[model samples]
Target: MTNHLEGVYQIHHIFSNINYRFQQLINSSSLRLKIIYCANISNEILRFNKEQIYSLSLNESFSINLIDSLFIYLESLRITSINSNELLLFISNFQSLPCLKSLTIKLLQCDINHSQIYYEIFSLKMLKYFKLSIDDYSTSLQSSSFNPNKQMSHLEYFIIDYQCFLPSITNILSYMPSIHYVSLMKLFYYRSSLETNYPSIWPNLTHLSICLTTWDTMFECFEVLISKIGSKLKFFSFKNYHRNIDYFNASRWENLILKFMPQLDKFYLKYTENVDRILRDRDNNEETNDFTRSFWIERKWILEIEINNQNILFSILPYKKQWFNEENLFKLNQLVISRININKYNYFIQDDINRVLNFTQIYHLEITNENLFIGLLLQITNCLFELRSLKIHSLLLEDDSRDLNLKEISILYSIHLTSQIKKIYLRNLTNIKQIDFLMKFSPYLSFFKIDYLHNLDIPSILRQINHTYLNSLCFYVPTAD
Candidate 1:
């Protein structure tokens, strides 16, 4: 087989384990290899052409020594899982893999000594692009200690997928003197207990993106951050889960940008809040044209607002593309579904009920109506061609005596076979008929979340759900029951 495929430059193998024949074939080939989910790979199988292979990607469990010994000349290496002890051992031997310029570790075992990890990672003098994601069990590094002489990393781009406090982020930035771009997957607020000094300004840093996790003192902490690095930032993006009314105050943002971020060429901001929390201000005749000011207009940044039954989203045009986005989240997408009604305070409106329906590229659809008829569901699925997930409050027939005609049945069957939906969330489900309809409608469904069984028993619902080949099943029950 290896003789027959002599010209092959790349190979991807997905297997439970590597055998002697596979090892012999890999040893003879000078191909860039991608081995996925091959667990407990023995060291003998990893003997390959180290000089011929410059890039390697592995998604499996194996000894750390294999990395240090086999990939000395590799320019890029990606590993899916690495524990703290293995990471520390690898750090101790960073000199072995001097050719490693781009390294990505997807999952690092949660350990408290993250400061040590950061310090060691910064010691990699030749690395340029590095991405690390730590598990949630790891706590933030309360204090960081770095030797300035040994920790100046030449890395130009960095992505950190762990949530860290403001001071912790600053501490990490202090060591990366050559970094031009940085992305913090989630930035948490600094607490009073963790005492640490913020770093000096990063003049070389040009691009920054942050997803703030805490609301308390979030703006204040960000303000302090801007005071240090704002002048040099050419691109900035911010995202948050909850809303503070001040975030929408365009004038405030304009003042900040003009005063500090003078070099800013592109800005992206997104914030969301639940409907109940912001409903009080919905009646107030507040103007929504703040974003239409000259500052934003001159920059050609247009504001887009999306309000659904659950939450309101505020974002700027040319929206930031996906960056480690959360899974199983269903939000209204304005790029796909347009022609929505503008609400009174210009925030929340009956947008989904608008008459103007067009071809929508939205991937997720959440129906919050009390009663969603079969015909309306068909219409929605027909328009949202890219829809992959559906969350409905209730599913029922418009009339009890009505039954589907030939066309309706035909449409339903088409949806069952052609629908891209892999997730179905049924909220306030009261009958088995709704479950039966949903199961048949989404034949490829992988995740089913039943928020509440209003009048149905838990055992019967579980028994019915047991029939589907689902990857996951979720149930939410209230205490009142």
Candidate 2:
């Protein structure tokens, strides 16, 4: 097997328990390996060609002493879940790997001073891309003087996957004037009166993504930072969890884009706020048209406003893609159905539903209607091109007096073969016939979760819906007995 796989350039080991011998591989000169190291291998320093391996990823915390035995001339290296001492040792070994251009470290150590880590990372003169994820909430940069000879990093890309304060990011950016791309997965704002404002040093920076997890009062500081560095951005994405009424000012955003961010080709904004608090402002009734201006229309950035579970979300994004997933199912379920319920009396009108819902953009859908009929479900599948996940609270048909006709059966069978739906959740299901009806149209379904199974033939349903993709089947058992 080793001889057969000697030509393999990329090797990814995802297993956690497999104790594969590293000595079996005699030729790993061109191998780009990703492995999860176990404690048993910590005592054995496995040797290999350190010069030819271009990339390596250690997915677990291994002995820091093993760093000396690993490849030194690696162009890219990723280490996950390392401690403070392990991080310090790795930093000491960075001096040996001058060819290392991309370095990623995910540190699990908490409640420790990360200032030294920050300093040593920036000292990597040849590094072009650097990403750090620290689990510690207090991962702030302490004041540390850089080496006089090595003042700045040549890094062109920087990313922080942890919640870091904006001031600390700005301080780090002061040493990375060559950076062109920056992504802050979670940015926080901790008020500090002594924090000094820095000028925009990254003249070549073009792409920026920031997810602000700060208090509402942090908007002012956030705006200041954007104004300084947002001028040259080609792509800008900003998401805020903290609600501020100022974020609703579309005119302000338009002005900022028109004046400062003229080079921006794409702009994405997701602002969420409490539904009751925002709707209380009656003056904002006409604010919906604020985003429909020529500026937004020219960019093809569609504006979608949704009210879900007590929160209202305002999103502005390009119309080229659908951003639906399991995490967004709760919101999409309400948004999609609300569009159909616009005319309360015409809820069952197929023509109105077809006109209201754009089937192409609707991927994941949920039907909470207690009075849903088989005809209405068939009408929905007629227009849907890429339906992925379907969750129905109750498919209790209003009229089960008749079975599907020849034409209806053909449509259901065609959808069963072509439909992209892989997940189905049935709630308040009381009959096996309803399960049989769903299984006919969802032949590709992989995940099925039923809310209840009182007196229903569960084994029969499972046998009837048996398929290779059916890996997950869940039922809610109310009692132990």
Candidate 3:
């Protein structure tokens, strides 16, 4: 019995079994004071055995009658799941737990007919964190009776997993005066319709995350939020498909950030499409040159080329020859070349190669699953002089692949271009020779990561390189066929 109880800090059971165990544990001192309980136990059972438990997680069927007994020992409670009916039943029960700190309620599947009672529950004086995860879309329209004007002095962290709604934001601002962190996930589109002034409501919030679709919508939503609370925001993250936009339009937000939130410290932007346009247009202004003008107009030409076969040949003609003198052509070509988007299997013209060689200020370069012909590789070797981080992703490996030769090029270029690189991440690198080459070139590199390299002798390579300055190394080998 002692051995059986040694590691058993938690017990989970159905209602009937919980009753029997509740009685048994109450009688036996050894089993009464367990740390956690997750079960469909009734309020009577929890009340009867209240003194022995420290943590409790009830199923949807948990009743409100248990609150009186549970609150007496609720300080250790960290997680809870309640349904609409249970919430309605337990509206008054919330005030019983003066020490309750964390609460998670499942309001997604529950009917909102009793949402008026929600406000009554928000009066909990000791609650610090609240997570409301709504599973159903229609439930968002239901207004909670929770009044915003009532002060929830202790509440600090609030998470709403649904669309952003005006009422929800207002209610939170009116209630939780101390909220510092807020996260909204799986937000629906309609919630953006809320017209409430933004910066005014969220003056105290410091950290925020919104998961939505499209960069345009995200920018608009952020504009609204910032117009009100931008001065107070310090950290921001946009996750999933919430803010999808073309690179050119997305870069406009830089001005928006500079204008509204001068104190902003951290920003993360990610998308699955081409980012070259966004990087190129980030500094666009009215005093642009012919080069910038031609670069800007070429996007229209590329789109036309995609739609019409006749323009493909003309579009394929070198833009440098058409734009400038032979002497200045190389320089203009390099500037325009960096602005061009790379699609599948396009041969690198001499201008493209020259552009890469001249663009020495590029600090981060990502070549992912794109075919880089030898000419392009040479240009990359020449231009990537100031690169601090390099990522080579999804390069295919054949028995006679050219990637095996990249290590030598990498070493030679790193020595000539600049020895500023401290991190290199290689994903799906199938060549061992390439690995050996990079090891020789970057002896002072601090971090090296290689994932999904086939048939590579990892241990032997580690022994050969024995990189003195390398602080982190990761290798993933494929299983035998």
Candidate 4:
């Protein structure tokens, strides 16, 4: 029967009949199996059961006798959600599984005071990858937690979510020789209370993300630490959200970036418009009216402005369209114009159009308006021919504007104007007739996103478009409405 079963590859009641059948298979000359068990089974099954199901179980502490017997045959095991008591029990019965290569234990909820997980986990000789996410307070209590001294000689990837009363850069740097990628999210603490000096180099760390929030003297303290470590830092993100902008000056930012980071590729700033304006104002003060003349001379790096202020337009322009020339200004790559009253200033239309055309390199463009006329639309489309990505927000079609129809508009302007455009975003296209006409021309478009269109036949419009190259399509409508 066993030979016949092996020939045909059938085991009907193998686990249930482990005592009678398990040893036969283990001893069989023909049978070969790599067992994988996912269900929660206990020590009682291991001791009394006749059949064997590869001897791997999810439950950590079944029974002492069962564990002892099963340890000989156990190839691999995974235990999850083990409490402090259960963890201690598993550690006490720790006989090495020679074939075990993979292990995962989630200890975010485990009680640090009662659990011996920290001490016992490092003793695992074969662990290749390890992940630990702990609450900030539990990591700082000077109890005999997991020491970083364990020679994880083979360990490749290590992730830790640490939240302690205090964060130590020295402690992290000590273990930096082995770690490749480090993600530090919301590691919040008061900087004034920290007693130790910061470290200079994190040798093997290729990637890092840190969020710091401080008050009063904390800014100065962080600045000193950053200056010391900034040379070795490759990728950096610094954000400070304070009510008083005066406290955090722009000079501090310039000193850090200009002095320290030579190989930095990407930098993100999320603060008020005043931050840039303040810097500009300071520059203008030093150079007087020759601000543009002295701008590039002092700062050798190319500065890209990500601005959302209409006031910036007014400030930069001496008198709308009359003062500023498109040829003189720096090239803008991305322009986001959102919900501003530009109808009062028709001169701005001609100036903005000229600016867009002159740049010829803008990759991303966003225009938001509730009352843009057909003439203005035509002018915009004419200039936006070089755009690679376009987004139109809250576009309202006037009843009595220019007579340029949608089909004519597409053929004459949009299709030819933006031949390189890959992504198009449209919002609040209340008019169905206009959208139906837009669907015909965009062929190279890979992404199309639409939101809040009441009258349009969405499904039919989607079917009409030849989206052979389309990678992403998104439609959003209010469920309640």
Best by TM-score: 2
The runs of at least 3 residues in candidate 3 whose Cα sits more than 4 Å from the true structure, single-residue gaps closed, are 1-36, 40-49, 52-54, 59-66, 76-82, 113-117, 143-154, 186-203, 212-222, 239-252, 268-481
lDDT of 3 by residue, 35-118 (tens): 444444344556566655555665444445756744454644433455666676675666777667777666645566433544
Model 4 Cα shift for residue 5 (angstroms): 29
| Worst window of 10 by summed lDDT in candidate 1 | 352-361
lDDT of 4 by residue, 1-481 (tens): 8899785554556555776687666656454333333236433444443133333534333443334433444444455445555556665564454444444444435565422454455565554455554444444233222344634333344444444322443444444455444444434446553554554335554444454443343556665655555665555554444322332344555556567655444444333333234433333233232212323223322222233443222112111221111222333245555533335434124343343233224545667665455445445555556555666765544545335555445654546444666677877666654454445445567777788766676776666566667887778866775
Assess the local accuracy of residue 114 in candidate 3 as a C-alpha lDDT between 0 and 100: 32
Worst ten in a row by lDDT for model 4: 315-324
Clashes of each: 0, 0, 16, 9
lDDT of 1 by residue, 168-276 (tens): 6666677777888999877776655144454554678899998877676545556666766788899999887557656655666787889889999889988675545
Worst 10-residue lDDT window, candidate 3: 304-313
Which lDDT values do the candidates have, in the order given? 0.65, 0.66, 0.50, 0.47
Q: After TM-score superposition, what is the CA distance of residue 234 in candidate 3 from its true location, in Å?
A: 2.7
Per-model root-mean-square deviation over C-alphas: 14.8, 12.5, 12.7, 12.7
Pick the winner on lDDT between candidates 1 and 2.
2
Candidate 2 wrong stretches, greater than 4 Å: 1-46, 49-52, 138-150, 190-195, 218-220, 281-285, 305-312, 321-481
lDDT of 1 at 73: 64
* Model 4 regions lying over 4 Å from their true place: 1-110, 113-118, 124-129, 135-156, 165-169, 199-201, 213-217, 228-230, 238-251, 261-389, 392-424, 427-432, 435-481
Clashing pairs in 2: none
Span of ten consecutive residues with least summed lDDT in model 2:
351-360
